[model samples]
Every structure is written in structure tokens, then in C-alpha cells.
Target: MVSFIGMIKRNMLVYLKDRQAVIFSMITPIIVFVLYILFLRGTFVDALEKYLESAKGLIDEKDIDVFANMLLLSGVIGSSVITVSYSSLVTIVADRQAKIDYDISATPVTRVKIIVCYLIAAFINSFLISAILLTGGLIIVSLLGNTYLSFINVLALYGITLLGSLSATTILMILVLFFKTTNSAGAFQGLLCAAVGFIIGAYIPISQFITPIQTICNLFPGSHITALYRNVLLNGVIENMNSSMNGLDNGSLATTLKEVFSLNLNMFDNYIMVNGMLWYVIVIIIVALIAIAILFNKLYKRK
Candidate 1:
């Protein structure tokens, strides 16, 4: 246990000492947030307006703005949880490149202990950053002055962020060992930055795609996690809008909006609710952790 904790501390200190790696790990989500402010926010608002074309004056425009921001915020959190976790694990690749893993293997620490320490350190670091992003997002959205996020909702957001970080850590742990050098990991991070936005429906919503494409994206735990975010953050605003409209569209608009933004996914012809998505994410984490342990034995190749 002492050696495990020491390894964790050593890994964290080395990773944190490199400011550029830390910054670039978080850069993907920040870039997505910036893009929303510059371009996508207006497009979403217009889409909502188009949806409400019949009852143009019914929905509060401020609420629409708030709703749009909720989507952007959720997408940012979703992308960050994975990107940050992956970046945190990049330290493992660097250690391998430097033959540091060889030195560590000569110690009393078991291979499992070393690997667990790597995951634990990454999880801690990723969750801390994700929590910061969540707090900042809530603050920014609150500036619109009409958000409907309750204390319970805030707690749930934190809960989802926790699960998100864990899921990302275990999932990425299996993938990280495939790269024995920092350069390969760095290149993959770039691809991940570009792909995650689409995978989680940040760049374009999963709803806009065909059924098969939607299924492909939704297969990822990150996509379901993002769906969880959409429900928690946007459901409150949606309730407010429904009250304002007084069932004006007979709940059709709310349902349509949910589908449009992927507040829920119709998988296997069944709608997946919060509890269902939670289960899915939990299952993914379990499977990923098992895979990581097995892969470490097979592929970590400590030399």
C-alpha cells in the first residue's frame, strides 16, 4: 500500500509539472465551448424558434437561451470528462518511453498495484478538473438569470461527473498501454479531441443522424453520459417551458426537443431513461475495468 500510494504521488507530480500536457488535455472541451459561443448557440436558438413557429410568442426567449446554454454546457462536460482522463493517462506512456516502468517493476510493488495506482491518480486528477468545469458552467449559465437547476440537480450533475471520470479512466486505461511512446499518444489525443465532439453529439446532435449512425454513437458510454447531462440540465428548463406553454403543443414539443438534443436515446426501440443510462454507464465501467486488468497482464509488457 505504501509503494502504491508513493507511485500515485510520483505520477501526479510528474504529470502536473508539465503545464503544456495539462493544458492541451483540457483544450478540446474549451475549444468546443468557444465554438458554441461563436457559432452553434445561435443556430440552436433558431432551431427552437423554428420548432415553435406556430406559437412564436408562447415560449420565453430567455428560457430558449438558457436551454441552448444547457446543451453547450452538457456537451462541454461530456467531452472534458473523457479528454481530461485520457490526457492524465498520457503520463503512463511517457513513463514507458523513458523506461521508468522497468525501474518501477524492480520494486516490491505488484504489477496490479502499479496499474491501480496509475488509474487512481488519473481518476483523482480528472474528476477534480471536471468538477471545476461543472462549477464554472453552472455559474456561466446562471448568469442568464433564469436557469431552473435545483440543488438536487446540481448534486446529480456532480454524481454524473464522478461516474464519467471513472468510466473514462477505466476505458482509457486499456487503450493507453497500446502506445509505448508519448508521440503516438499525443497524436491519438488529437484525433480524440476531434472525434469526441461528434461522438457525444456536441458538434452535431446524434438525433440529426440516421438510425444506424445514432446507434453507433450511442454505443459509447460518453454518449449516454451526455444524455444524462441533457436530462438533468435541460429537463428543468423544459418543465418551465411546458408550464409556460400550458401544454400548448400537448407535450409534443418537449418530447421532440428531448429527441433532438438526445435527452434520451431510443435504443433497441426502447427509450432509455436516467436510471437506464446510469445502469448502462455502470456496466460499461465494470466491463472496462475487467478488460483493463486482463490487458495489463497480456499487453503491459514491462521490460
Candidate 2:
């Protein structure tokens, strides 16, 4: 057990020591926030205002801002877990590039232990960074105005974040195993950061996309994870706004936004609820882990 922890510790150090990996891991998340403040925020607010056409006079503008920002917050947080996990896994690719993985595989520690250590370290590193992003998000939204994030809501997000991190770690591990050089991994992570916000409905609502594109994004677990975050982050605010409007045409807004944002997803021609999304992500993680185990045997030295 101690050796296991030590292996994990070594992985963590490799990730932490590479300042480029650490900074780039966070860079995409920061860009998401910055883009939201400068561009997307106004766009979202305007789009939401269009949705509020019937109840404009009845609803406070600040209420709209709260909802928009929370939506942004959820997306930003979601992107972080994915980007950070992929970033943490960069260490594995770096090891491969350096031929250090060959040395480790030759050790008596066993391949399963080595794989598990890398996964655990990535999960921990991603979750920690994701948690910090959540903290900053909550604080920023709170300072701006009323955020619906109660203590329980925050705790639930942490649990979801944990799952998101693990899913990302497992999935990225499979990708990492294919990388013979850090350059390949680096290039992929760059694209991941560039695309993740859009794919996860962080930048634009998936509903606005063409049917096939929307379907493709829904097939991804990260999009479903964002759905979970939306439910936790914005549900309360939706409920309150509904009450404030008092049937002022917003009674369906909850249901509408759920559809619009892919908060309640459709899978295989069947509608999926929040709980279904949870299970779906878990299933994806399991599948990814199984694949990783198989790949390690074939791709890495099985010694």
C-alpha cells in the first residue's frame, strides 16, 4: 500500500514539476472565464432576454445575470475537470517520451499497480484544481449577487466533480497510453481546451446546433457531466425565478432551458433524466477503465 501511494506521489510530482503542464491545464479554464465576461456574457444575457420577452417587466435584470453567470460557472467548472485531468496525464506521456516508462515497467511493482497509480494521481490533481475553480466561481457569483449555491448544492457539485475527474482520468489514460511522445499529448490537449467549452455547451447552447452535432456532443460523458452541473447550479435559481414571475410565462422556462442546454439529455432516442445522466457517466468511466486495462497489456510492456 505504501508503495502504491509512493508511485502515485511520483506521478503527482512529475505533473507538478512541469510548469508548462500546470499552466496550460488552467489556461483553458481561464480563457473560458475571460471569454464569458467579455463576449459570451452579453450574448447569453441577450439571448436570455429574448426568452424573457413576455416577462421582462416582471423579472429583475439582476436575476437574469445570476442565471447567465451560473450557467457560465457550471461550464467553466466542467471544462476544468476535463482539461486538468488531461493535463495531469501529460506526465505519463512525458515519461514515455523520456523512456522512463520503460524503466518503471521493468520494476517488480506490476503493471496494474503502475496504471492505478497514474490514474489516482491524475484524479487527485484534477479534482483539486477543479475544486479550486469551483471555489473561485462560487465566490465570484456570490459577490456579484444572489447565487443559489447552498451548502448542500456545493457538496453535491463536489461529488459530481469527483466523478467527473475520475471519468476524465480513466478516459485520458487510454489516450495517454497511445502517446509515444509528449508532443502528441500536448497537441491533443491544446485542441481539447479549444473545443471542450463548445462541445460541453459551455460557450453556446447545444440546442442551437444542428441535430447531428448535438447528438454527437450528447454521446460524450463530459457533456452529460455539464448537464449534472447545470441541474445543481441553476435549478434553484430557476425555481425562484419561476416564483418571482408567478406564472408570468416562465413556468415552462425550467423545462425549456433544460432542453435548450441539454440539461436533460436524450440518449438512444430516449429521454434521460439527471439521475440517468449520472449513471451514464459512471458507465462510461467503467468502460473507459476496462479499455485502459486492456490497452496497458498490449501497448505497455506486460512484464
Candidate 3:
């Protein structure tokens, strides 16, 4: 256990010492937040206005802005999880490229301990980065939208963000093991960082995509993580909207907005609830962890 902890500390120190790499890991999510504020925020508000026209007379305009900001914040958290976790793979690739793994292999440490140490370090770094992003997002949303989240909602967001970070880290660990060089891992990470937002519907609403594209997004845990985050973060806003427009047939509009923003997903001709999505993410994490253990064994034998 002591050796395992030492390995984790060593890996973390290596990752943290590279200031440029740490900043690069967080850049994509920060850019997405900036773009949403500058460009997409207005577009979403304009689009939502048409659907919310009936409630305009009843609801305050500021409330609508608050709801929109909450929705965007959820997407930002989703993007942060992927970017940070994927970027954490740099530590694993660095170990291989620097032949640090070989040095560790010559010691008394078991292969499983080394692999677990790397996983633990990655999880910690990714989770810490995600937590910072989530806090910043909430603060910005509160200031910009002139609203505050409930205490329970804040706790729930932290928990969900941690889970999302874990799932991303586990899956990436498996893929990172396949790369023998830092350059190849860096290349793939760049592509993933660029495209993950679209895949998880962070850059655009999932509903705007065609059926096939939507289906592909649904297959990944990232989309479900976004859906779960939105479900919690925007629940109050949605409820207020429903109450303000009571006795009105706004069910279709409400449902459409939820689907578009990834608060829900259509699965096998039926929409899955937030609980169902949470279970799906948990299952993915379990499967990915098992795969990682198996890959670790295979690589150890080769070493």
C-alpha cells in the first residue's frame, strides 16, 4: 500500500510539474464556455422565445435567462469531465516515453499496483480539475443569470461531476495503454478534445441532429452524463416554467426542449429517464474498469 501511494504521488508530481500541459488540459472546456457566452447564448434565447411565447406574459424574462444559463452550465461541466480526464492520459504516455514504467517494473512492485497507482492519480487530477470548473461555472451562472442554485443541487452537481470524471478516466486509461509513445497519445487527445463537445451535444443541441447521429451519441456515456447533469441543474427552472404556464398545453414544447438539451434521450423508441441514464453510466464505468484490469495483465506479460 505504501509503494502504491508513492507511485501515485510520483505520477501526480510529474503531471503537475508540467504547467503547460496542465493548462492545455483545461483549455478546450474554457473555450467552449466562452463561445457559448458570446455566440450560442443569443441563439438559444431566440430559439427558446418562440416555444416560450405563451409563457412570456406570465413569466419574468430574467427567469428565462436563468434557465438558459443553467442548461449551458450543465454542458460546460460535461465538456470539462472529458477534456480533463482525456488530458490526464498524458501522464501514462509520459511514463512510457520516458521509460519510467521500465524503471518501476524492475522494482518489487506488482504490475497491478503500478497500474492502479496511475489510475488513482489520473482520477484525482481529473476530479480536481472538474470540481474547479464546476464551481467556476456555478459562480458565473449565478452572476450572469442573477440566480443561485439550491444547496442540495450544489451537492448533487459535485457528486455527479465526480462520477463523470471517474468514468472518463477509466475509459481513457484503457485507450492510453494502447499507445507506446507520447506523440501518438497527444495526437489522439487533440482530436478527441476537438470533437467530444459535438459528440456529447455540448456544442449543439442533440435534438437538432439527424436520427442516426443522435443514436450514436446516445451510445456513449458522455451524453448520458450531460443528460443527468441537466436533469438536476435545470429541474427547478423547468418546474417553475410549468407552474407559471399552468393549464396550458405546453407539454410538447417542454418535452422538445428537454430532449434537445440532453435532459433526456430517446432509446429504443422510448425516452429514458434520468435514473436510467445514471444506471447506464454506472454500467459503462464498471465494464471499462474490468477492461482496464485485463489490459494491465496483458501488458505486464509482455513487459
Candidate 4:
């Protein structure tokens, strides 16, 4: 166990020294988030207003605030998923290319220990990427004039992101173990991550896609993670609102915006938070175990 920890620590140290990797994992996510926000600012505001009226008095005066917070959190989670999968797969492939697996195999260390060390290292990378994205997101939000930040929401977002990122990384690790070749792992991981990103609405508005595609996407960890953010951010939607109805009847974006920005409380409670985070952890564990079994089989067959 101690040796495994040492291995993970060593990999982390190496990761810190890799400036290119650091930038790709940390900087790229924030940049992408900023760009995405800039491009979708209008749509976001419109959606926020429309959704606010749907909640009625159930949520008061906090639609814009909640929407902004949710957007930032979702960006952090999405970026972390990308960062973890990219780093974990690329690093493992590089190690395999260098024959590090055989070197470790020839040593006293067990394959299980080696795999655990890899996972730990990947988790560390994922965690750091998440932290950086969160901090960067907060700065962006602050600069954009959103002062009503909820630390509790931030904490929930972080927990969900961490689990989601780890889950995606674990799946990639399975691919690495199964394929063995650096080229195979790299190609598969890149393509899979891109596909998952689209399916999860990370890079595109995947939710706007057809129901069948969306249903298929739900099977992926990325989709679930993003859905958690969407649920929290867009919880208790206002549906629509008309001014003549005194905020009681739903009507349109303009009316909903007028009503939504006037609230002070959240539309949805903690239930969504509990469910979303629980789902990530449960799914991650199940996937990780299955991945380990697959890796063991591959290794056995190779031997």
C-alpha cells in the first residue's frame, strides 16, 4: 500500500513538471468555458427568464443567479471530465510505449498495485484540473458581475465533478488496458472523449438533439454528470410568464425574466444535489470494478 502511494506520488510529481500537460489540462478548460459563455450569452439569458416563470413562487428572484452559477459549475465539471480522460489515457499510453508496464511487472509490485497507482495518479490530475477550473470560473463570474455566489452549491458541484471525472478516467483506463498499444489507446480515447463530449452537451447542445440520441447518451458518465449540473442550474424552471397574469401564469421569456430576476430563494431544494452526486459515485464504482475485471482478463490473455 505504501509503495502504491509512493508510485502515485511520483507520477503526480512528474505531472507537475510537465508544463504542456498542465496547460492542456487546466488552462484549456477555462479558455473554452469563457469562449462558450461569450458565444451563448444571449441564449443563456433568454433560457433563464423562460425557465424562471415555470417555477412560479416556488422559487423567488434567483433565476439569473442560479443560472449563472449552474453554468459555471457545469463548465468546471465538463472541463474536468475532458482533462482527466485526456491526461489519464495519454499518460498510460506513453508509459506503455516506454515498456514501463513490463518493468513494473518484473518488479515485486503486483498488477493490482500498479493499476491502483495509475488510478490514484489519474484522480490527482483530475482533482487539480477541477480546482483550477473552479477557481477560474469564479474569477470569470465575478468579473461578469454575478455577486450572489453560493458556496454550498459550489461544494456540491465539486463533488459531482470529481466523481464524474474519475468515472470517465476509469473507463479510459479500461480501454488502455484492453488495447495495450499506445496508438490504439490514444486514438480510441480521443475519439471516445470527443463523442462523449458532444453527447453530454459539453461542446455542443446535445440535449437539443433527438430523444433517441439523448437516451443513448444517458448511458455515458459524461451525460449523467452534465445532467446533474443542468438539473441543479435549471431546477424549477418557470415555464412561461405573462405580465398581465401577475407572475402567476406562464407566458414568455420577457415576462419570465422580469419575474425570475426578482427572487431571493432557490427554485429547487437539495434533493437534486443528493441524487445527482449519488448517481455519479455509484456509477463510477460499478464501472471501475468492471474495468478492473476487463484489464485482468486482458493481462491474463497476453501472458
Off by over 4 Å in 4: 26-31, 46-69, 146-149, 233-247, 250-277, 300-303
Q: Where does candidate 2 have its weakest 10-residue lDDT segment?
A: 261-270
TM-scores, all candidates, are 0.96, 0.96, 0.94, 0.73
Worst 10 residues of 3 by lDDT: 247-256
Please, what are the lDDT tens digits per residue for candidate 3 over residues 126-179?
888789878987887777765546899889889998899888989888889899
- Order candidates by TM-score, high to low: 1, 2, 3, 4
Clashing residue pairs in candidate 1 (N, C-alpha, C atoms within 3 angstroms): none
2 against 4, candidate with superior TM-score: 2
Candidate 3 displacement at residue 70 in angstroms: 1.5
Using lDDT as the measure, the top candidate is: 1
Top candidate, metric TM-score: 1
Residue-by-residue lDDT tens digits, candidate 2, 188-256: 888889899888888888778877787788888898888899899889887877787787663787677
Q: Candidate 1, after superposition: displacement of residue 29 in Å?
A: 0.9
| lDDT by residue (tens digit), candidate 4, 122-203 | 7777777776766676576567544444677667667766777677667667656656565776566456534544656654
Query: RMSD in angstroms, candidate 4?
Result: 6.4
In the range 1-303, model 1's lDDT, one tens digit per residue, is: 676788898877776777987898888788888889899998888888888787678888899999999999989999999998998899889988998888988877778898999999899888888899999989988987678988999999999999999999999888898998889999999999989999999878888888888888888899999999999999998888877778767898888889888888866556788899999999999999898889888876566
Model 2 residue pairs with clashes: none
Q: lDDT of each prediction vs. the true structure?
A: 0.88, 0.86, 0.80, 0.58
lDDT of 2 at 98: 85
